[model samples]
Target: MTGGVRDKDRDAARDDTLRRFLLPIGAVIGLAIVVFGTAFLYDKNGAENLLAGIYQLLGNNAGATALRNGGGDQFVAKLVLAAMALLVGVGGVWLLYTGVSAVVGLLSLRKQQRIIPWVFVLPAITLLGIYLVYPTIATIYQSFTHGNNGAALANPLANYATLGTQDFPHVILNNVIWLVVATSGSVGLGLLIAGLVDRVKREALAKTFIFLPLAISLVGASVIWQFVYAYRPPGAPQYGLFNAIYTAAGGQPLDWVHTQPINTYLLIVIMVWLQTGFSMVILSAAIKGVSTEVVEAARLDGANERQLFFRVIVPMIKGSIITVATTVAIAVLKIFDIVYVMTGGRSGTDVIANRMYDEVFQFNQPGIGAALAVILLIAVLPVMYINLRNLRHQGVGA
Candidate 1:
C-alpha cells in the first residue's frame, strides 16, 4: 500500500507539469482561432479585409479612392485596425499566460502567489507595449518609405537629406531657440514665483492667477495671442492690442508673424507663459516638502534668505526642478499647435513639428516627414531616459 501511494504521488506531479505547459499553448491557439474567425467572417484577407469591409459598411468609399491617391481614410482605417490588433494581441497573450499560471497554481502554493500579481499587472504592461512600442517601430519603418505609394525611396537616405535643405536651417534654429528659452525660462520663472508666493498672505490667489495660462490649451492660447500681435499695416487704426499700444507709443505696427527670428521668440513666449504655471505648482509642492528642521539649521548657520534659497532649497529640490524642465523640453520638441495655428509654418517660423506636418500632408512627402519625426525621436529619447533615471533615483513609482 505504501508503494502504491508513492506511485500515485509521482503520477500526480507529472500530470501537473504537463498541464502547466500545455494549457498556455492550447489557450494561445484557441485565441488565434477566435480572432481569425472573427476577421475571416468579414473577409478572406482576415483583419485587413475586415477593416475595409467595416469602412464600406460605414458608407466610407473615400478610403478606396484615397488608398490609390496616397493615404487617406484607408490609411486611417488601417491605423485603427493596427491599434486594435495590438490591444487584442496583448490581451490574448496575457490571458493565455495567466490561465496557465492559475491552473498550475492549483498544485503549487508558490505558483499561486506569482499568478495573482501577473494577472493584475499584465494589462497595464500590455497597453504600454501596444501604444508606445508599436507606433515607435511603425514610424521608424515609415520614415524609409515613400509617403504617397509606400514605395521604397530612390535613396533610403533621401528623406533625411531633404531635412538638411537651406530652409531647414531656419527650422532647426527656431526649434533650438524654443528649446533653450522655453525650457529654462519656464523653470526659472516657476522657481522664482514659487519662492515668492510661499510667504505671501494670499498665496492661493497669487498661484491661481499665475497658473491660469496653463489651463488654456496651446491652440487656444495661440488664438488669444493672435489678437495681441495682430497688425493693421501701420496707421489703419491699429486693431491688434500690441500694434495699438505700439502705434500710440509712436512705434511701428510690426507684422509679428511674418518676421523671422522674432516670430520664433514670440512663439516661445506663449509656451513659457503656459508652462511657467505648471512648473510653479510642481516646484511649490517640492518646496513645501523640504524639511523645515534642516532649513532652520541652515538659517542658524548664518545663511541669509538669498543664500538659503540658492544654496539650501535649490539643492534639495533639484530633482523636481529637473523633472519640470525635462517635461517642458518634451513639449518644446513636439510643439506644433501654436506654430500651426498662428503662422501655419509660413515665413521663418517653421519648427520641426510644423515642418514635418507640411512635409507629410501639405507637400505629400511622407518619407521626409517620417525622417523628421525620427530625428525628433532621437533627440527626445536621451532626455526621456535621463528623466526616467532621475525619477528612479528619487524612488518615484517605487
Candidate 2:
C-alpha cells in the first residue's frame, strides 16, 4: 500500500508539470487566433461578404434593404473595425504579456528572475528604436543629401550653409528671443503667482484660474488669441479685444499679429500664458515641500519678508526653479503651433520648427528641413541634459 501511494504521488507531479507548460502554449495559440481573426475581419473583401451574409440572414425585408443601401452596413463595419483595434491594442497586449511571462516562469528560479525584467522592457525598447532612433538617423542622413531624389550632395554641408542666409538668420534669432522671453516670463510669473497664492484663502481656486490656459491646446490658444489680436482696416470698427481697448483709450487700432518683431513678442505672450500655470503648480509644490522649521529659523534670525523669500525660500527651491525654466525653455525651442496658427510664420515670426515644416511639406525642400531639424535637436539636447542632471541630483529616478 505504501509503494502504491508513492507511485500515485509521482504520477500527480508529472501531470502538474505538463499542465504548467501546456497552459502558456494554449494561451499563445489562442491569442494568435484572435489576432489573425481580427485582421481577416478588417479586410475589405471579408467585411463586405460578412455584411452581405448578415443581411441575407435577416431576410429580404424592406428595412434590411434600406439599411444596406443607406450606408448602415458601412457604419457597422467602422464600428467593428474600431472594436477590433481596441481589442488588439488592450486585450492583445495583455494576452501576449501574460503568455510570455508564464513561459518565462517555466525556467529555473534564478534564470526567471534574471530574464523577467527584460521580457517586460524589451517591447518598449523595440518601439523606441523603431519610432525614434530610426527617424533621427534617417533625418541626419537626409540632411546630407541633395534634392528630392536624395542624391549625395557634392558638399554635404550645403543644406546647413543655407541657414546663414535668406531669412534663416532672422528665424534663428526669433527662436532665441522666444527661448529667453517666453522662458523668463513663464517661470517668473509662475514663481510669483505660486508664492502669492500659497498664502491665499482659496489657493486652489486661484491656481485653477491661472492654470486653465495650460489645459488648452497650443493651437486652440492661438485660435482664441487670434480674435484677441484680430484687426480690420484702420477705418473699420475694431473687433479684436486689443484693438477695441486701444480705440477706446484714444490710441490707434494696431494689428498685433502682423506688426513684425513686436508680433513675435505677442506670440510669445500666448506661450507664457499657457505655460505659467504649469510652472506655478510645480513651483508651488516645491515651496510647500520647504521645511516650516527652516522658514521659522530664518524669520527668527532677523530676516525680513523679502529676504526670507529671496534668500531662504528661493535658494531652497532652486532645483525646482531650474527644472521649470529648462522645461519651458525646451517647449519654446520647439514652438510651432502658435506661430503657425496665428501668423503662419509670416512677418518675421518664423521659428525653427515652423520653418522646418514649411521647408519639408510646403516648399518641398526636405534637405533644408532636415538640416533645420538637426539644428533644433542640437539646441534642445543641452537643455534636456541639464534638466535630467538636476533631476538626478534631486534623487529622482534614482
Candidate 3:
C-alpha cells in the first residue's frame, strides 16, 4: 500500500512539471496565431499601399523616367522609409525575444534543460538551410545543365572544358596577376605605414584619412579613378590626369584601359589602394598587443630596430598578416565592380568573376557561369579551411 502511494506521488510530480511548462508556451502560441490571423484579415492592402507610396515618391505620375533612375531626387523618401522599416524591425525582434524567453523559461523545468538550447537555435538552423544550403546545391546542379533552362548539356563536362580555352587562359592569368600584386602590395604598404605611424602625434588622423576609401562604395571608387585614367587622342585636349601628366612630360597619350598587362596592373593598383587601410588597422592592433616585456628583452639582447621588427614583431603578428593577405586575396579573386565599371573586362583585363558575369548575362550561358562560380568556390575552399584552422588554434591558445 505504501509503495503504491509513492508511485502515485511520482506520477503527480511529473504531471505538474509538464503542465507548468506547456501553459506559457500554449499561451504565447495562441496569442501569436490570433495576431497573425487578424493582421492577414484586416491589412490585406498593406503591400499594395506600401508599393504605391514608393512609386508615387519615385515620381511615377510626372513620368520623370530619366530622373527616376538617377536616385538623387528620391533619396530622401527612400531614406525615410528605410529608417522606419528598420525601427519597426528592431521593435519586432525585441518583442519576439521577450516572448520566446518567457515561454522557454516557464517550460524549462525538470529534465527538459538539454532541449532548451536546440529550441532557441532551431529557427536559425532552418534559415541557414533554406538560404545557404539550398542555393549551393541548386547552383551546383545548374552548373552541368544547359543554359538557363533545366536541360542536360550534350556533354556533361562541356562547360568545365571551356576553362581550357584561349580567352579563359587570359582571364585566369589576369586573376593571378591581381591576386599576387594587390594582396602583397596592400599588406606590405599597410604594414609599413602602421609601423611608422604607431604612437606618433595625430596618428588617428592619419589612419582615418587612409581608411576613408573604405567608406566609399567600390563602384564609386571605380568612377573616381576612371577620370584619372581617362584617355584622349594626342591632338585632342588631354583631360585625363594621367594623360595630362604624360603630355606635359612629352609622352604619348596612352589608353590605359585598352592596354594589355599595364591596364591589368593599373586595376590591381586601385584594389591595393582600397584594401591597404584594412590591412594596416588589423596589423596595427596586433602589433600593439605584443608584450612590451618581450620587446624590452629583445632590445637588451642587442637586437637592432631592423632585427627587432623582422625577428620579433613580424613573428608575433604573423597571424594577423596572414589574415589580412588572405582577405585581400579573396577580394581580388572575386573582384567585379572595379573591372565592370572601369574597363568592362576589355583588353585582356578579364578576371574569373567578370568573365562569369559576361557568360551568364551578356551571352546567356548560365551553365558556363555556374561552372566558373563552382570553380571559384573550389579555389576559395582551401584558403577558408586554413583560416578556420588558424582561428581554432587561436581560440585554443587563448
Candidate 4:
C-alpha cells in the first residue's frame, strides 16, 4: 500500500508539471489566434464588409451604400485597423514576454535567474533599435545625400554650410531666445506660483486654475491666442483681447503676432503659459518634500522668509528646478506647432523644427531637412544628458 502511494505521488507530480507547461502553451496559442485572426480580417476587408452588411440589415440603406462607396467603409476599416494594431502591439508583446518567461521557468533555477531579466528587457531594446536607432542613423546618412533621390552631394558639408547663410541665422537666434526666455520664465513663474499656492488655504483649487493651461495642445493654444492677438487696422473695432484693451486705453491697435521682435516674445509667452503649470506641479512636490525640520532650523538661525526660501527651499529643490528648466528648454528647442499655426514661421518667428518641416515637406530640400534634424538632435543631447545625470544623482533608477 505504501509503495502504491509513492507511485501515485510521483504520477501526480508529473501531471502537475505537464499542466504548467501545457497551460502557457495553450494561452500563447489562443492569443496568437485572436491577434492573427484580427489582422487577417482587417487585411481582407472582412470586418468592414460585415459592418456594412449589419448597417443594411438594420434598414440603413444609405449607411450601407455609404460604406460601399468607401466613406463608411474607410471609417470601419480604420476602426478594425486600430483594433488590430492594438491587439498585435500589446498582445504580441505579452505573448513574447510570457512565452520566454515560461521557457525560462522550465530551465534550472540558476539559469532562470540569469535569463529572466533579459526575457523582460530584450523586447524593449529590440524595439528601440528598430525604431529609434535605425531612423537616427538613416537620417544622419541622408543628411549628407542630396534631395529625395539620395544622390551624393558635390560638397558633403553643403547642407551644414547652408544653415549659416540667409535667414537661417535669424531662425537659429529665435530658437535660442525661445530656449532662454521660455525656459527661465516658465520655471521662474512656476516656482513663484508654487511657493505662493503652497501657503494658500485652497491650494488644490489655485493649482487647478494655474495647471489648466498645460492641458491645451500647443496648436490649440496657438489657435486660441490667435484671436487674442487678432489684429485689424487702426480705427477699426479691435476684436483681439489685447488690442481691445489697448485700444480702450486710447492706444493704437497693433498686430501682436505679426509684429517682429515682439512677435517672437509673444510666442514665447504662450509656451511659458503652457509650461509654467508643469513646472509648478513638479517644483511644488519638490518643495513639499523639503524637510520641515531643516526649514525650522534655518529660521532659528536668523534666516528671514526671503532668505529661507532662496537659500533653503530653492537649494533643496535644485534638482527639480534643473529638471523643469531642462524639460522646458527641450520643448522650446523643438517648438514648431505654435510658430507653424500662429505665423507659419513668417515675420521672423521661425525655429529649427519649423524650418526642418518646411525644408523637407514644403521646400523639398531633404538634405537640408535632415541636416536641421541632426542639428536639433545635437542640441537636445546635452540637455538630455544633464537631466539624466540629475536623475541619477537623485537616486532615481538606481
Best TM-score goes to which candidate?
2
lDDT of each: 0.82, 0.87, 0.79, 0.86
Report how far off residue 389 is in candidate 2 (Å): 5.7
Error of 1 at 284 (Å): 1.3
> Clashing residue pairs in candidate 1, if any?
none
Tens digits of lDDT, candidate 4, 89-196: 667667766666776787788998999988788878999999999999999988887754456788888888998999999989998999999999999999999988
The worst-scoring run of ten residues by lDDT in candidate 4 lies at 38-47
Query: What RMSD does each model have against the real structure?
Result: 8.9, 4.4, 8.1, 4.1
Expressed as tens digits, the lDDT of each residue in 1-398 for candidate 3 is: 99999999999999877656765665576556446534533554433344445667877744344234443345554454455455445554455555565566665365348657676787689899999889788888888776544457887788888788868888888888888999999999999888877859999999998888988888988888888999998899999999999899999999987787799898887888899999999999998999999999999999998898889999999988988898888888899999998889988888999989998888888888898889888979999798689789889655
Q: Count the backbone clashes (under 3 Å) in each candidate.
A: 0, 0, 0, 0
Candidate 2 local lDDT, 225-338, one digit each (tens): 999999887889998999999889998888889886689999999999999999999999999999999999999999997898889999999999998998888888999999
Model 2: which ten-residue window has the lowest total lDDT? 62-71
Better of 1 and 4 by lDDT: 4
Report the C-alpha displacement of residue 241, candidate 4, in angstroms. 0.9
Clashing residue pairs, candidate 4?
A: none
lDDT of 4: 0.86
Candidate 1 residue lDDT tens string, 97-197: 65555455555677678677776677679888899889788888888766454667877677777778869877887888889999999999999999999
